[model samples]
Target: MKVLEKQARTVDEAVQLALEELGVSRDEVEVEVIDEGNKGILSFLSKPTKVKVTVKPKPEEVAVGFLNGLLHFIDKNAKVKCLPEDEILKLEIESEDAGILIGKRGSTLDALQYLTSLVVNKNCEEFVRIVLDAENYREKREDTLEHLALKIADKVKETKKSIMLEPMYPNERRIIHTTLQKDRKIVTKSVGKEPYRRVIISLK
Candidate 1:
């Protein structure tokens, strides 16, 4: 949300000035006429109109602002780019210090994503899914997970023994489960609780 107060000769003029300053259309903002100018005698004695203009809440903008501040706070000269669509907002972090933001196995990235999602959804009428990624980290990690699933499936079949993978986040487990679902000869199941949940691959 962004707000500006402007004083002009009329309410409409004040609103127009505010809109121009905010860089948004009239319909995109909520305007409140604080004081309608009074032409006491002639235009020389008139009082100026005052109004407050607020840009409606926009989730993508809020997310970008929050992420940029957070990045700067962490002493990183990163850039935030937004790709917005219906029900989803994707933010990409570009910087030379990508490794720090990504953290081990993308834990830092995931944490930042969670915090950003919370900020974006605050006071919003609808929930929007947020995805934060650095250097296409999510896609690269997904590819790696898919490959791991296939390799482990092959190993399980070759050794004729069930294999339990290290605990993985829910989405990671989902990738493993979905990738192996087509293999009728191989079965995948997730066991244990979240943050410690492990995926099991064995003979069906």
Candidate 2:
């Protein structure tokens, strides 16, 4: 965030000047009226109005900064590319050693994304959702999940018995549920508590 103090004939004027210097609109800044100047004795100006202005951090900027800082600890060459969408901030981490950050089952990537989102929304009026990906892991994982769902559907139909899948993140579970949602012969339900929640596929 960039902060500045400006003095002018009035609070509004001071804030306007600050905004002009900062090259940002009023909505993008937090304005604090430090002093409402007053007219002194004999029609003399006592003190000019003073205001403190600070630019609000945009969600993308915050995400990039936060993820880059974390990436530095893991890999110096790692870089985060932010692609902003209407409702989500998409962060793509590119690194020669991306697999390290992705970790087992993308645990590390998800952890970093969670932290980045927390930091991004800490001051936001409307929460901004973040979609973090590394080496297109999310799409790849979705494809894998879809394939698993199809295979499980076949197994369930052949055995006439339900199969409970391994624990999955909410997103992964969503893939399972959505992948089989349209199938007439298969049904999917989430069971167990979080961090161990599983999808149970059964014959419809």
Candidate 3:
């Protein structure tokens, strides 16, 4: 949050000055009239209106700032672009070392997205969903998960034994579940607690 004080001939003028200086819209800030100016007797003595304005940084700005600092801390150079689509903010990171940022199974990227969302919606009145991706990692990961699900389902059918996959996040588990939902030969069920929960594939 940033605070600024400005004075003009009227309260509205003072507020406008503060808004211009802060580079934010009226709804993004809080304005308080510090002193309502008075035209003294006979107009000999006059006072300028004063206002105090407090501005909150927009969500996109916050997301960019956070990603920049994070990349710097990791000693990695990446280009981050923030795109606002309706109520969702899509953050795309492009870099030659995208693999490093993505980490194994995109766990690092997921962590970064989670932290970014927390920072962006910290003081917001309405929460916005943040979607973060690096070099199309999400789509690739989804494809890999769907393929693995089918492979595992085939193994389950042959061995007549239930196979429990490695633990995965809910989103990944959902991909597996949805991919095999229509298969009449096998069934998928999620088991265990989060961060350790996995999908169980068994022959029908």
Cα-based lDDT at residue 113, candidate 1: 97
C-alpha lDDT score of every prediction, in listed order: 0.92, 0.92, 0.91
Residue-wise lDDT of candidate 3 within 33-100, one digit each (tens)? Answer: 88999977766598889999998778999999999998887746787999899889999998888888
Q: Which of candidates 2 and 3 is the stronger one according to lDDT? A: 2
What's the TM for model 2?
A: 0.94
lDDT of 2 by residue, 1-204 (tens): 899999988888899999999999999999988888886765564778899999998889988988888888889999889898888889999999889999999999899988988899899999899999999999999999999999999999999999999999999999999999999999899999999999999997
Candidates ranked by TM-score: 2, 3, 1
Deviation (Å) of 171 in candidate 2: 0.5
lDDT of 1 by residue, 63-132 (tens): 9999999999874689999987766799999988899999998999999999999999986777889999
Off by over 4 Å in 1: 1-53
Candidate 2 at residue 110, lDDT?
91
